[model samples]
Target: MRFALVGTGLMAQEHIRNLALMPGNIVAALVDPEPASLAWARRSLAESFGPATAEIPDFADVPSMLAAVEADAVIVASPNFTHHDVLLLLLATDLHILCEKPLCATIADAEDVVARSGGRRGIFWVGMEYRFMPPVTRFIEDVHAGQVGTLHRLALHEHRFPFLPKVGDWNRFNRNTGGTMVEKCCHFFDLMRAIVRAEPVSVFCSGAADVNHRDERYDGQVPDIIDNSFTIVDFDNGVRAMLDLCMFAEGSEEQESLVAIGDRAKLEVGIPSGIKTLSPRVPLGAPKAVTREHVAVGDDVLAAGHHHGATYFQLRAFLDAAEGRAPVQVAARDGLIAVAMGAAAEISAREKRVVGMREIRA
Candidate 1:
């Protein structure tokens, strides 16, 4: 399958590398306003493309790319703020779309995309690749299979370094990147929804731009994106989920961890470690029955990108669905919900109060 990559920046380069790992998939066209970004993409493309495939066409905009290239699908890896506009150009066509997360930076735009993409002939999948991580995937499966029987609580923690520099430093601000919560934590919210098997009811988040980028200024503007946060979400299914995010913990052993507890068992998973643990309920002072197993992901797969091979797995699954082999796993509605949940968190953090999901929906 041939794919046109819109916005040839960091995530787009990741997509290129992951797609290059696929057997017959090729990145046919590149679209971005920044020539430097386009050049970065070209360098990455050189890693796999041969002589005949050397001269991949590049475009300054999506329209020109659409006019020049014939592709099986398009991957929209553009900056967060450009999603709604970029999608407007592509939504007019029948090509399958794999839009990167948050759906949109705001609820209104997300709802618009979901409504417009509903009845299209081609599949519309969002890039919620966290769902495809090997350990997380196993964790989710185990939770759903009753390992964490009658689920009640979930806690997801991400302790990592600060956001990387982006093209034009577009990611350092709330307006451009959806205030870190919608931009970064949408994945967690989406994962929370998936594990809880329900929509969120209310969100309360206490966060601030506590660290990272404090000494930096772009065009005389201080970065306002939050660097650390703890958000609690109440789900309709009676599950309570919390996200503990800290962007300054570069030395942390596990970059991410997830815990789910229920009446019957407790399940936990850690990334990088790829360790999954299950501990069922036991009577007090009795022998504990617990299991800890490492979920193995191939070294080459892990080398493809930072997502722990999720991009490659998600792309392959997307290819399968595009070729009529499977159904779209993450739809536009899922993206919308995730974005809404993030918006709720952002609002709650900013206002110092709980934000109801209905308020966001309305």
Candidate 2:
């Protein structure tokens, strides 16, 4: 499939690298606001594949490029703020879309995408890559298989070291980025929903930017956004989940881990390494482990890739759907629900009350 990628930041380069390495796909052209980023993309393509690839300065002006390239799909890696507009624009074309997570900055825009996308022949997939992780996929399967018996509770911890975007970049500010929860933790919320396979009945959360605000990293100019949060979610099946996120942790490895409990057994998934289990369903008291092997650790799929190799799987899935080989992996509705959960967490933190899921949808 021919691809046109928008945005040329770290994640974009990672995607280009993976796409270059993968078979049956080619990055026909790249569009970015940054000349350097575009140059880097071209160079990266040259280094990996060859210099035969063409490059463009901006996707905003890609009508001619689109006409010339005949791209089968467009990958939107722009910041959270521009996601909706770019997506809406791309949707106007016949090109299928594979966009970064959160879908849009607000629920209204999310609904716009949903409303306009109805009955479209092309597939629109949000990049909620965790759903593609082997460990996460297996964990969900084990739970549903009764290996973990009746689901009980879940706990998720996600930490990153002060994700301050480029100062001039729109995403560095809260209003533009859709808050930390929506911009970053939406993946986790989506994962939680998928793992539980139940609707989120309600959510209560508490958080603040207390730590990052004081850190010198912000240059005394912190965005009006919470950098840390503790949220409790109620699932329709009587399952409860506690999620903690801290963006100020100083660690070489991005901290991400999940613990799921059930009547029969338990599962713990550690990102970047593998998954470890302590299942009573096993013959002995010992636990087994499952690792992500298809893609190398720290490969674009894990670090910059978003939830292991989800980026690759997501891209492939989008291509498949675009080519009528499969169905949408993550639909617009799922994207909205994930965004609503993240937004509700922020509202819960501010209002000092349980922000019900209904309020989010409403």
**Highest TM-score against the true fold, candidate:** 1
TM-score of each: 0.98, 0.88
Query: What tens-digit string does per-residue lDDT give for candidate 1 at 1-362?
Result: 88999999999888988887888888889999999999898888887565555689999999998888898899999998999999988999999999999799888999999989977787999999899998999999999999878999999999999999988888998888778999999999999988889989999999999879999988888899999999999998889999999999999999999999999999999998999999999999999999999999998888889999899889999999999999999999999999998888899999999999998796
Clash pairs (backbone) in predicted model 1: none
Q: How accurate is candidate 1 locally (lDDT)?
A: 0.91
How do the residues 129-238 of candidate 2 rate in per-residue lDDT, one tens digit apiece? 87777666766776778766788898988877777455255655668877878888889899898889899988898898877655443456756777888989999989
Model 1 misses residue 120 by how many Å?
1.3
Backbone Cα, N, C clashes tallied per candidate = 0, 1
Residue 18, candidate 1: Cα error in Å is 1.1
lDDT of each: 0.91, 0.76
